[model samples]
Target: MNLSIFFEPLNEDVFANLEKPRTLGSYISYFVSKFPDWRAADIAILGVDETRGRSNEEQAEDASTAETPARLVRRKLYSLNKGAGRCQIVDLGNLRPGISLDDTYLRLKEIVEVLISHNTIPVIIGGSHDLEYGQYMGYEHLERVVNMVTVDSSVDMTEDPSVPPNKRQLRQILMHEPNYLFSLGQIGYQSYLTEPEVMATLEKMHFEAYRVGEVHRSIQEMEPVIRVADLLTFDISAIRHQDAPASEPANPFGLTGEEACQLCWYAGLNDNLTSLGIYEYNPELDDRELTAMMIATMIWYFIEGFYHRKNETNFTSRHFTKYAIAFTEDNPDRMTFYKSKNSEKWWLEVEPLSAEKGTRIVPCSYEDYLQATKGEVPHRWIMTQARLG
Candidate 1:
């Protein structure tokens, strides 16, 4: 695909000022005079300036003034010191907004599909949360059921006609034709902000929803959930207004900046997760670009975790410790779990009902193994079984 035509080169004046030695900008190859060679890259960073999907048209109009949200984020990201990993990252430049919002989505979908087809992970920045629908659609032709993890303050599933696309994109994804979405797991959603009917609907469909308080109780438990995702979309509104004041309708209660980074780290470590999007940051509303820096740090942690992946899926290998548990004497159902010696991560094997289906390896936690040891089936195991059945 001739990608250059779809993107506008990064503003040289903004990045040229990043003259600090050993900074991340010094290590990254980005589009300025020409598009970087993305074919050999491990990860590609792409920015989208589109914000027409936002509910507040005034805010969207203000976004187009001078420094875009994406550019502001880039400025912060470039100023940071280089990570420990040897970086082969490319910045694809900001995408040119199409004549219509739907047209912009189509362009994003095409770009994402092309990058993923070459095994390059796309780390998307800027735009409204609604752009996630385009990111999800990129996997349509990949011929596999996709598991998604979304971190947001609200469910974004509204059916109200007056609601803008950013607030209702999740419903579009759930009801999209030629459905390939296998499961959706939401994290950091505030109960008061979410509709009771939508919550019940998600439950009836067997989808997972984690309340903000639940995430606060134990952020570690959310790792297994994130580990199973093929794509992840994080809205800055999931962070507290004090920490991320640039968010649309900033909430007083949400994840802390540190907790948000931890989730990104977990997502990066997942071999299954192919793409990530960080959205809903309005630079105009920011407190001296503090929110922009927060988002940049989150991206930094994700990239750092990416280089630390162990790739430990082989159960028969010497790098794993296996445990077998029989659920009950009468039930005679046995479950197997594998713990990675390299990373201490856990996974369980689910037996397939038919020969054609084959066995499935599900990401899990040490707690799940303990549940089995006590003669009880883990909820995750039950959910996987139900979904597979």
Candidate 2:
């Protein structure tokens, strides 16, 4: 179902989030072209608005019962037929009506399964970080894939899987075998997680992350952490509190709008980027000029990432806009880097020459580094940097 056509009034709650001076859609229409490149040809974007609240939850009453307000999914004609390559955007905001969050997730999964089986990439936009419960579930059958990345401000690590009214982290649900899930950008920590060590546990599992201070450097420097994942799962909250705060994670850590776009571009360019999801965008908390616009622009960045891969283009300029604060910690199992042949997932990959081994780069680290596998059975580390600006 195409979901981006319809325009609706903002919900009453999260009114504070919507306290913007201008409209966001307008901003998206204005500046999407001036951002990161995404792998549009290789990866398809599915924008789903399957967000819902339980009858007992606080915002349950605010959901719209509309069937098809504006369905982008319907318009694209991105079928799962043979040779169905390329990522398509599926706006779930209209596909299913009045379904529980669980059911909605299942419904989304059915569509995703169809795409994945056809060897088409699914760049999913979301209802919540919770929807991934089903996304992760669907990935089990894919043979070559076994990794998922969560780019957000909070870990969502608490364990309790009941339902809309009461649910928990993947630790509660994905219990069978260990999954290669990583969490980046749990910066600007607030009360969402009960403990600070939740971050530590995630790191222990290789769910690496950065604080507000760490991301201050260029995203170019931090690429190693996320490069390891098969799929890059982006939570909109990963953006800063000032940048895009209309989503579930309003108070995010470091990284500017450009870095977020770059990361999405990285996903779009990657060859192994099996799936991508961007979530927690609440119209309630967005400013017409800032939040929503930022989202739309970011969406363009995802596309830009893909396009660059398809055309083998370079950024207008790439001197690391956010590289001042790249700090490297004393990581025992610190990541080694690698290089790629410019074809990132959508088209993004890695490549690098022989570099001395010193673990983390001292001072502020470069965010451009990514974790790529080079050996047999398992993966080996090789350091890579983008074509110098």
Candidate 3:
């Protein structure tokens, strides 16, 4: 599969202008007509130039006009220092927009499918949030259930067929055929912006949607939630308008620039996450590259966390300590938990079914342990059980 045909190389002038001494540009492989030898790389970066999803919105002009978003991001990215741990990363440059918007999605889906099949993570710089639909579609041939976590200011649950996907992408993903989605989680949603009915629907479906205030209260709690996702997308508009003013849906209050980086770090640490997209950055509305720098820093943190990953998935290993807690004195059923001696991260073990060969380990916080100990089940545990059933 010659992926180069689907992508164009980053402009040589862009790289030539970057100060190469101790910068990220010196380390990463960027595509030319010849693709980088990406088989050994841990991650690949791709940029999309399609923004038809913004056409239906009132502020379509704020979306990226073809290559501007990627170009600005690349400039900022080249200036950052590579992380402490070694990581093989390849930048695939931009995917040229197709004849139609659907054509563009098809192209992205095929490219992403190839990357994931090769076990290389794709860090996407998107033209609009709806491009993530293609990212999700890439998993169709993988023959496994996928969980998606999205960082957005609002859940796009509108059922209006006339609306562009940026307004209702989540609804489309949820109803897509083959039903490969096992769960969906949303972080950094603003209560005021999201419709009450949409929130109620999320609860009814038992999917997790965290408010911005909840994340501010305990950012650590977000790590486990992010760890459960196989794919994640960060909507740039989720950051406060002051920090990330370039997004069309930008709001007065939301996650801080620092908090956005922290969430990305958590996503990178997850053993299950194989794909990530940072979407909706509009350079036209940015203030002197401030938003671009913030986004670049988020990417750097994600790569840092990726390199620092500890392979703690093996429960039987000496690296883990097990605890068995009974919910009630007379109850036969008990919850099993594992704590990593290295990272001190917690995981709850779910009961295996008849056809299952091993127990299912779900990411959890210490609070989940406390809840189970008090004869109460964590919502995560209950949701996992229902999904498995």
Which candidate leads in TM-score? 1
Compose the digit string of candidate 1's lDDT tens values, residues 174-274. 99988998889999999899999999988877788999998999999999999999999999999999899998786889999999999999988988888
Clashes of 3: 0
**Count of clashing residue pairs in every prediction:** 0, 89, 0
**Local accuracy of candidate 3 as per-residue lDDT tens digits, 145-206:** 89999999999888888877787988878888988998899999998889999999898887
Q: Give the least accurate 10-residue stretch of model 3, judged by summed lDDT.
A: 58-67
Which residue pairs in candidate 3 collide? none
What candidate 1 gets wrong by more than 4 Å, as runs, is: 56-65, 352-356
Q: Give, for candidate 1, the lowest lDDT window spanning 10 residues.
A: 56-65
Stretches of candidate 3 exceeding 4 Å from the true structure: 56-67, 352-359
Candidate 2 worst ten-residue window by lDDT: 380-389
- Quote each prediction's TM-score: 0.96, 0.59, 0.94
Q: For every candidate structure, what is the RMSD over all alpha carbons to the true structure, in angstroms?
A: 1.8, 12.0, 2.5
Total backbone collisions, model 2: 89
To one decimal, what is the Cα RMSD in angstroms of model 1 from the true structure? Answer: 1.8
